[model samples]
Target: MTTYLLKSGILLFIFYLIYRLWLENEKMFLFNRIYLLASLVFSLLIPLQLISFEPSATSKIISVQLDELAIQKNSQSFKSLAESLDLTNIILAIYVTVFLVLIIRFLLNLFSLYNKVLRSEVQFVKGEKIILINEPILPHSFWNAIFINKQEFKNDRIPSELIAHEKAHLDQKHTLDILFIEFLQIIFWFNPLVILYKRAIKLNHEFLADAVVNNQFREVTKYQSLLLEIASNKTNIILASNINYLITKKRFIMMTKKESPARIFLKVCSIGIITSLLLFVFSCKDNPEESNTKKQNKIEKSSVGIEEKSTLPDEDDTVRSLAGLEIKPEFPGGIEEFYKFVGKNYQAPEEEGLKGKVYITFIVEKDGSLSDFKVLRDIGYGTGEEAVRVLKLSPNWLPGTINNKPVRTLYSLPITIQSPD
Candidate 1:
């Protein structure tokens, strides 16, 4: 478990670096405003690595032991380990699901891009004597003569000012930005932080474009009306662009924000600091602890004494000798005997996701016969039954003694079905 956490942390750092350099290309805000991006990145990466590792056989065994300790939960420390295992599994599932979704979305976007690039029917809006080259990208509105499918503009009259707004997407190359974010979305689909980043970049794209349009186009009120006019239509797809659409009211407010440039820069820096600290702390903490000494498992003593007794106990004599009364024998004399029986009798059943835990408990009669069994931890299907069959057939045990008398006892065994490490 400790090893897994450390590995996950390392993967996350690599992922972050990958994001900042290759993905962001210094154009995005991984370093700019850190709060959302940094935190989001953390959430995203942690889940992803947690899931991707997918608990090896040893890890699954460890998890089961932890879970048993949890079930029998007497120790707070052991219980915590068990809880952590559960948490890891949950995080793993979420990360995998998210990543899968992101991959699908990426493929969808890619297909869309490929389809568009290969498309025909170029329609350029003619301005009497001025001929224009219709860009397939931005300002994809009826006003700009760039409608993909034309149910969009039957009797609608569009204002010219809105055309400048979408043109900003083109002039500033926001389509590429959109594509970049779309690509990132596919890669880090499991990370909600990346999703947030996409949204932020997208919103920022609009804001930047809005600022450009407002700065360059001199017709503010007219453009606002144009925005309202074109706002009637929005693209059906999330990645698709509508000429006049607002993602959030906040984008509108940013357009009117009165904050000085200094304050904005300070805010960005503050966010950066917090995010850097979080990533650093998270990455650093996952490393193995420094210890002055290392510990190894103490020797595993066999259930049977080191020496073997060659003489077989006489059945009736054994019953009569101990406490003067007959008792059914319990578990095979020792752990070695128990497992040897299992090895000889064991059968692997066909079942997936059965590699967690298999706990069994049975009554050991004074004569060593196991009966009335139950699965303490059943892996699945025939696994628990297989485990039971092995235990039940293990001949006689040296019946447990109570005051020089033989007695039946309940013996509990929890066998974790871990893969060979």
Candidate 2:
């Protein structure tokens, strides 16, 4: 999960950098909108390894190996890793708590908007439904509803241009985009790039709406003056698309700027190239030659002292990593049962208040027998040996297989031992 988040976060940063450097200032509101949304989607999906690309013949593929079975000690006999309040668990707890708070805040905002819409008077202007609230807030749009001050409407102070701007937001369904990014922000509250993405997305929305209103009215100076006036009054509801969002100098400049087709085409091509590079870096897999080389290296590294036991034929001596297997090995019942067996059977060391982990690696042979046991790390007082003893007594695992044939696969287990006070 950490690795996935890191990869996705990096992708998002790169995509956002591209937008800021190449597309942010351009007068391509629709294209920029599509690019921002698509950037978020691709940043998420690309890291999941859902899209696989064949490595080119000339491309160098790097293979990273990880433990097949990384079971944490969380059975009844021992204190669960999470219950110990380790740093990882604490961080996870904080993240989840913040995420829930953000979710609740988002719901409250939606409810407030809904409550206001229900209580205020509704009117139709130029074939659009407008919510007239008895407050001195700037005009904004949420989903299908446009919100404005009831006093402004009664005094005929709300301009048609303002109504048109909010209408553009409603017609384009900008609320959905805002809601989408809001949900993303809730999930990735820790990621700074998500904040940047929300800001960029909202700013682009303003650009899009401004372009529409300017084109409709064909009076850029008048619209800019109205935007300045609206900017003075603030809207507290973030979920709503306000007409006065980020009324910056750039927004005013983008109103009158013109972009050439060639410039847009070139920038888009650059983005495509960058995206391709990211995909190749994160999603491409090793080719057949590289796979065989990695398998050979893994077998050589794991084959240290093989016990002469009644086993499979000599031709089946090739040991493979658990990841390359078609069907991975499993404990007698399941992984959880195996953890229970280890926790129940293993005896902690007699050290006073000892707290550390024992790292053990062993190979599950083709004949479903364990062999090549190695104690990679051991705290003092025979903790590693005790872990090995418990594992040796474990029932034979269902050997991992490739193409319906059983193969030896290496497994690594780390057991945490915390002596009681």
Candidate 3:
């Protein structure tokens, strides 16, 4: 999840740079709006894509055996190698916590708006429902209802041009755009670019609405003046379409600027760059499929403690395992005899503690020796140390092979230590 968010942030930064440089002043509001939304979608989806590369038959396959390594993880020290697996869970918990907080905030805004609508006096003007609030509010549109302050409505201070501008928002269904971006913000709350995306989309909606209203008036200067007056006493709601001072200067400039078709070409070029980057990231050679389950019944032996085996790549093409081989590794007698050796030598810590499972992962070297002993998870009280102690003293077994040749294989084992019930 951390890797995914990093990739998404990088892509969003690149997309935002492209927009600022080539599309911001182009008078292409609709295209820019789609481009911004699409960039967010692509950032989220691109990291999920995967492509596999097949190795050539003659490619050099170096099966390096992991050296004798013991990783100790206990209550005092978390710097152990096993934390590589635990870090994902830690990051996921944090991400979910922030996401839920943002989701609650978003819902509260929607509820506040709904409550205001319910309390306000409502009437239809030319088949459109308008709401008059008792408090000060700059004329803004939410869905089909237009909201304005009671003073503005009673004193006829509301301009027809402003109503027409908000009507354009309703006709174009801009609220859906706001809601979509807000939803994304809830999920990717940690990402700064998601916040920028919401701002960009809102500004673009204003551009589209301004374009519609400017066309209805003979003199555009008059409408621009009215926009300035509205901005002077504006009460902007994030979820509502209202006149905003931050974006007003840009909107005024965009209203008079001539449309540029070349900017559309730039939009295409930006999308192409995004696609190329995504492909490069997703199809990278090291994107491995994860496996968490232990492989069973792979240990079988002959009288001499050497069992021949044919091996193939694992399902994810990331690791070679005993299960993927035609003939697997074994102990002197078989798997039953191997477990008997562990059962006798393995000692549970007498210290009273939680009854749980300890996960161990080790590499079966090409020389049929167990090395790289990792104490993945433990309940402490010296139990993890004891498991490592017994494994390091065990006898050598048959190694796994691929295509009738000896190859290093990885194995995972779970040793459950039960307490007296």
Please name the candidate that would achieve the greatest lDDT relative to the true structure: 2
Cα-based lDDT for every prediction: 0.46, 0.75, 0.67
TM-score for every candidate vs. truth?
0.44, 0.76, 0.64
**How does model 2 fare in lDDT?**
0.75
Identify the leading candidate in terms of TM-score.
Answer: 2
Supply the global lDDT for candidate 1. 0.46
- Point out the worst 10-residue segment of candidate 3 by lDDT: 294-303
Model 1, poorest ten-residue lDDT window? 291-300
* Candidate 3 ranges beyond 4 A from true positions: 50-96, 266-270, 273-277, 280-421
Q: For model 3, which pairs clash? A: none
Off by over 4 Å in 1: 1-119, 123-138, 141-160, 171-173, 180-196, 286-421
Where is model 2 more than 4 Å wrong at Cα? 54-89, 286-360, 365-369, 374-390, 398-408, 413-421
Q: In model 1, what lDDT does residue 413 have?
A: 55
Each candidate's clash count: 18, 0, 0
